[model samples]
Target: MLCRILFAVAISLQRVEAVDPLVDVSYTRYQGTSLLNGITQWLGIRYAASPVGALRFQAPQDPPSDSSIQLANEHGLLCLATGASPMDNTTSEDCLFLDVYAPTNATSKSKLPVYFFIQGGAFNANSNANYNGSGLIKASGMNIVVVNFNYRVGPYGFLASKEVLAGGSVNNGLKDQRKALEWMQKYISRFGGDPQHVTMGGDSAGAASIALHLTAYGGRDDGLFHATAAESQSFASMLNVEESQYQYNNLVIRTGCIDEEDTLACLRSLNVTFLQKNNFNTPSPGAQVAPIAMYNPVIDNDLIQDYTYRAFEQGKFLHLPAIFGDDTNEGTIFTPKNTSTIGQSDTFLQSQFPALTFEHLRTINSLYPVAEQYPNSGKFWRQVSNAYGEQRYICPGIFISNAHARDSVSCNWNYHWNVIDPVSAAAGYGVSHTVETSAIWGPENVNGGAPASYSTTNSATVPVAQAYWTSFIRSFNPNTHRLPGTPEWGAWTLDGYQRLLFQTNATAMETVPDDQKKRCAYLSSIGVAIKQ
Candidate 1:
């Protein structure tokens, strides 16, 4: 009788567990929770093995196969970041996880287009834990699936040295991202996503990553993605792996591993806390106003064979349908506030790229002359801001758009997001970098509300912006499913260089400004010397 009772209890447990949404990717089974908003999310699924112990600083390896029913409920610990302070408990080195959001009714047969987004934090710190695809899914009429994942950042992700090159990978962070994309291509069909129709999207550093991937392996198409969306794409100085030896040496000295003969092995053997304590000791890119990123991607030749500008110029990047654009005042948030003279501004540029020669500085100053005509509180702030914005973010975007246009393989849509938030305007950041992020992802979803004004007076802009984004994910063209009555986004061309200006109540197509065009041309000519 006792044996019979135990069997009966086991049967009851099985019946109760059967009601939740489940997906089987052959090697593993995931039980997902259904949210009240008709969205089902399978969160915190490991795509790669923990990059700890012998795996530290190495290319990502596939996770071990498992058959158990894993609960995909909460997110995993964020990857340890450099200089992210008061260091929180919710961070770890074993953080190679991803999340998937889709309509509740989606099945293996749904085959919805997928949007795989890479979060931006200047390559030093940041993760995709806070992003929610519910609003984006709803905006797409529940016709798509979205994926976000974490990649190793800072030293763990980007440490480069001769010792490292011999034993481990040079660009582990980027390798982690590529691993996640490969995971999607293999397993996304189980989540009702089309492996063949994936769209890769990102902002800032994330966008910059997509740019690198486009040119990775000398433009070798990896069959990972079909389209691209790069908002505020950055083209910073990318030193070859050898040039980044100073960063590696500084880290070794700080961590007390300088005496170790096998520095890479010594680093892998050290405790994570000991290593993290010294991560911030490395040289930082940018100035007082820029994000404090101590490390950046190095040109590894294996992955990044040449500078991005040369890749595009030689037509060595994958030609794909893409959309590239930036916010109006991208540099306001990244430029120094007290640069009162042209010399100080040159110093700021040198801080970002120490390799900038005196000739380059002279040319840069000549191109960006003192425009006292512009409104600003600082003596040379606006001029410096314009120079930083164009050289770093804006011009790179335009160059890539033009490169795509030269290919003429597929349509490339470009936009200038000039919509101002009252809060940002008051803070002296007029339509600054990442201001349109809330417009793309719903206002309420990002970090609980940085641009909460979108839900208030600027509410009308949300649907229009999301419509263009989601429409591009669903179809290659943004105009395909763009909201009715909104100005049609035109494909950028070498001749016209037309782009849609996204302003509240006055959205329209405009030609690339002559001032910006001339500046970008000069910057593009010196792309090699700047190591862009």
Candidate 2:
């Protein structure tokens, strides 16, 4: 889910003597620069060929090599996003690019660990530009390389139908990520990154994408990543290829492709402007500010063989040591206020989970009573938040963590993020979605993230969270005493599961059990297992 009201800040570029950074992939040379804080950033590196023209709606293909030194010094053009405002207007179909941030002091022999992050936008919004891994490079104490990149999104990324399936390429966006990983495996050594030590991390849709990769091909070892970290990971029920045919046909109708001799060809031929303008990103009244994910990765036969929940139950995922968690009130922002009464909430629930039957809706309503049941507002918003948080973010976290813990993997830990920005607290959003996103990026660039008061909580959390993350990146487990006041992060266990509680307040190192165990169980029983 995208966070609200993030004013983008500009980073002033500094010119230093060309450290003469270079990467030669099959004779194609990329000359980058050591620009910020001694971290050599190689930007706009192509991981795959442009997914345009005949390549539209197809899996990512190998990037053709170049002869000259291609300068990877700028951010790649963003994938065309639906509903992007006119002010921050920058997008294109030629956005299959990745950016690498490495320590200048490091060499090809350094073999430093790599942290690859995917930006979150509910799979329809956001780009790699939202996150600059420069901060994370410094936060890792010059020991790790950070990578962020753009992937296809929305209709271009994921729009399913018989035509889409028959085209022999579905979930192209996921494939784009896979291909990027493969590229890093073959080429990151030139950039001082360890391919075998790559740790994948992200928030929201990015995290969800990681989960799909974990289960891709029924746990086949692709050797793409070694460890994973996720915040507010989604367990949203995914639609099968055929199940998304209605949406696909609807998109065809909306885009004037329905009457074409070759509707798929018509879709393929449409320009970025036309396609971005015509999309499935219409916000549902149900998700409030958050999107309902009309376009997302589906259970395509290749990448995703079966339901993710069923896959997890059957141990059909690459079991790795992971750190995953959710915020305290993850659902508040997604829970719309217009849903007040039980009937209205039921209506909203039906819209959000269209597959749910009336009985399922009734069960959900019973599980989450109206706000009258709470102390303050006599509306169902907070109740809705509680239910949605447990169902989507919190419970899926528990389920996935438990799945990892049950395996022989060591130090699979979970955490609860309760640290709300003072601005967000005053506005009643609580520690909402993507609150830790900036913190995960680390404390190098400071603006718009810290609270006004700048309490001890603020001072400690910034680096403390960084320590937990960097430790995990350096080593699979986050158990660290590097940062002052940071707690001993314990692993999730079948005997006694525990999660670290992260708060802006002091001594918040408290280990707690799953917060909403019963509610999560109820959700699982009702088959509200994953979000599409």
Candidate 3:
């Protein structure tokens, strides 16, 4: 399979005609291919230098000018991570690279829109190579240029501590993302993309990063991206730098960096292989506690000034026109099997969010009652997914959309991705996190991707989604730039907060008032009160 992928990429690069111009770098003519009929792709272009050696924990630096034409024939290395192993070849520390896909006809003068994407894995897994943008470029009829890059993940990306703060940036991976965006602004026009009209989008962790960018530094707009889209956006709520110091300390002690005068320097100098193995070899997460998920964006009062929902509720975010949503049953997979009893479930919730008081968790648990509250519900843990899902995925969508709506600036649109795939339906995962990404990205390449051939619903949703999204990238309104036959998608308003539900059922795909309102409201109450 690896050989086949490498072959495909190599073939694509070889097919490039000498007549096609190289991308706008001061180096060798890194010519790529017109791989697909109407689209061209330049793969694994480094946006930043290799983050190896002493540069491991530092923020990504700009890709320096080189005289050699760096052949971008294949995907970049998968950034080192733990818990979730590499989906493709060779994980390494030198993984800061991106790929660009555009219409074959595009040129510096074309000014086509840009769609920048980020992949998801709870800050622990996945990579840019896993999500090739061919499907998107094809879906958009080769009219847009799509960008995807690798960012540090797991401990390498998000671990925070006083030592880390005193040394380098917290959330190094997110800063990697920022650097990539800056790269786009500097060079995308060379590939016929309009950097000024860039729209950043993602699923799961990628979506969480998008949300953070929205609120980074009290909603500052550094002209990075004009709009955003997020699926299953993570709203884990920020852990103050000190709040996660225990994780940092544990890592320090385990890695034998403890007692070093310059602990951060010790961490930076440690062997990459040793650090990744130990720090990321976390215990498997139980149904309710995504303990390792805490190794994510920290509240450093810089990139993140406050908790996610708090930033939303308090009206601090980039306020870009955004389209955000979550999956139906977002918690089925995240909900652990061990917490069958209500007591165990409560314990799990408290352990996950230590800041929430027992009294608060108890009241919240009552709202998501166990014991077949709904006539067809099964075990307590099954039902417990309701609260867990609401707390983690579903409500955060509502929270941010509400926050965007309150601004009354951009016409924020929200969505609910309940689209079922054959694989998920077979496993009873039911419209879980990242299901829509497959359809949007097309088939066969991504994890849980659209199959070799799309199903009936995928056929319906793909064009609709691509058209809707690319249209938004072109013009901030999903309705205005819609495909000829695309359905009307309205804005999510504070009073009329409706979501476009993408599902297998025909009627289920239209705009409707959010069904998770009450649960999301309860989540808001807790988040607002506890300030999570």
Say which candidate scores most in TM-score: 1
lDDT of 2 by residue, 1-532 (tens): 0000110100111222323487787847787887757888888888999888999888898888678889877778888675664234467787898988888877776777789887777777763354667777777677788888899888778878889888748888888888889989998877877797888998888888888889999889979998899988876657788877876777788889889988898888886566666664543333332246677788877779877677776788987768889888888777775556776665555556666677777777787765423333437777777787777778778778888877765658888887757776666667888677767675434335544433444656766788788877876667542476566777787666678887764524444444367677667666534243
Error of 1 at 335 (Å): 1.9
Residue by residue across 108-202, what tens digits does model 3's lDDT show? 76777789998887777654355777777776656678999889887788878787777776788899999999989988888878777788999
Write candidate 1's Cα lDDT for 31-149 as tens digits: 88899898899989899999999999899998988979999998877888888652578888999989999888777767788999998878887643558888899998888899998
Candidate 1 wrongly placed segments (more than 4 Å) = 1-20, 284-292, 369-377
In angstroms, the error of model 2 at 207 is 0.8
**Model 2 regions lying over 4 Å from their true place:** 1-19, 85-88, 127-130, 282-291, 371-378, 443-457, 505-515, 528-532
How many residue pairs collide in each prediction?
0, 7, 5
What's the TM-score of each model vs. the native?
Answer: 0.92, 0.89, 0.89
- Alpha-carbon shift of residue 346 in model 2 (angstroms): 2.0
lDDT of 1: 0.82
- Backbone clash total, candidate 3: 5
Score residue 525 of candidate 2 by CA lDDT.
Answer: 62
